[model samples]
Target: MAKLTAEIKESLAATKTAYFATAAKDGTPNAVPIGAYKLLDDETILVSDQYFNKTLANIKENPRVALTFWGEKGGYQIKGTVTIHTSGTIFTEDVAWVKSLKATLEPKSAIVMKITGVYTIKPGPDAGKKIL
Candidate 1:
């Protein structure tokens, strides 16, 4: 089974940039650039405010999602289902949660996701995970 590694956590926490992939009802995948996503736990993730777009809507209808992070060396791909949150709650009811999304610039428009699995891609120069 896929597991979250220290390296994966480091990359996700260190880089604030990622591309979220959501699919239309027909199963066509749509990818967009996003900057605010929080790993609430080993399986939960939070975006921000009304920041959800097609991807968000898609996730609401179909919880399946793919979130990714990349750098000069390599990157990790996180795929999971998002449990929709339409309004505020104890977790996202303060500036601290708001402050975490400063990377997004538009902190007010953010959406979070709950990750379920972590996939290693472009593993290394000598070894790599097969993209299947």
Candidate 2:
């Protein structure tokens, strides 16, 4: 697993919105903006499933996922494997965390992503290069 750098950790906190991508069994790609997401540690990223239908379904079909976000400086894309927690301590914690940010929002589940790769998404000569 690739550990998140200090810069990327700061970027995640500063980023207002992040894009999460997954694929269906048929290879259909799905990407959506997720506002309720955070880094649990260096490698683990948790995304609260407020209201996901196709996204949830796609996760079951394929575990591979990617998340991209941009801060004031630049953007990054992280590729990883996913594990969905429907009912557990993680789920409970996620609901509480999301509720603290968005009181009225209902959290259905938590999507836990284990970072395996990292890449620069910023537009430059280093774009698309794997940093980890």
Candidate 3:
């Protein structure tokens, strides 16, 4: 697997929140912010607590998900495949790598995303202009 860029990593870690989008079985989409996540590996993401979550249901309905992380410097919009594991052991092996960060995470809540593609979010004032 390829590695995440420093900017991408920083964007995710630097912020306490992230935005994720997932689609229902019918392809209808829903998105919302998650308070926490830890990078399991260069291509994997671990999120704690997957309950009462639209993303979780969407992932159940469709494994594909998109995560968008933003920071003061910039932000990354990541497109990846997700596996929502309700069990605590979901990404156990990866936790050691995130011990310092784990101190600030909510236990018994976890979801992992295997990143596949990424893009940058740069909204400009003129971005809203529609051209057909």
> What's the lDDT for all of these models?
0.64, 0.91, 0.69
Using all chains and alpha carbons, the TM-scores for the candidates as numbered come to 0.72, 0.96, 0.74
TM-score of 1: 0.72
Best-to-worst order by TM-score is 2, 3, 1
User: Which stretches of model 3 miss by more than 4 angstroms?
Assistant: 91-109, 124-132
User: How does residue 1 of candidate 1 score in lDDT?
Assistant: 27
Tens-digit per-residue lDDT, 11-91, candidate 3: 787887788788999879998887657787888887665344676677777888877767766677777787666445564
Runs of candidate 1 exceeding 4 Å displacement: 1-3, 88-91, 94-96, 99-112, 123-132
Model 1, 5-55: lDDT tens digits are: 666767777876788888878898988886656666665666654355677
Sorted on lDDT, highest at the top, how do the candidates line up? 2, 3, 1
Error of 3 at 101 (Å): 8.2
Query: Per-prediction count of colliding residue pairs?
Result: 9, 0, 3
Pick the winner on TM-score between candidates 2 and 3.
2
Q: Best TM-score goes to which candidate?
A: 2
True-structure lDDT of candidate 2: 0.91
Find the 10 residues in a row with the least total lDDT in model 3: 123-132
Give lDDT tens digits, candidate 2, residues 21-124.
Answer: 99999999999998998899999999899988888999988999999988775679999999999898999999899989979999999999999999998788
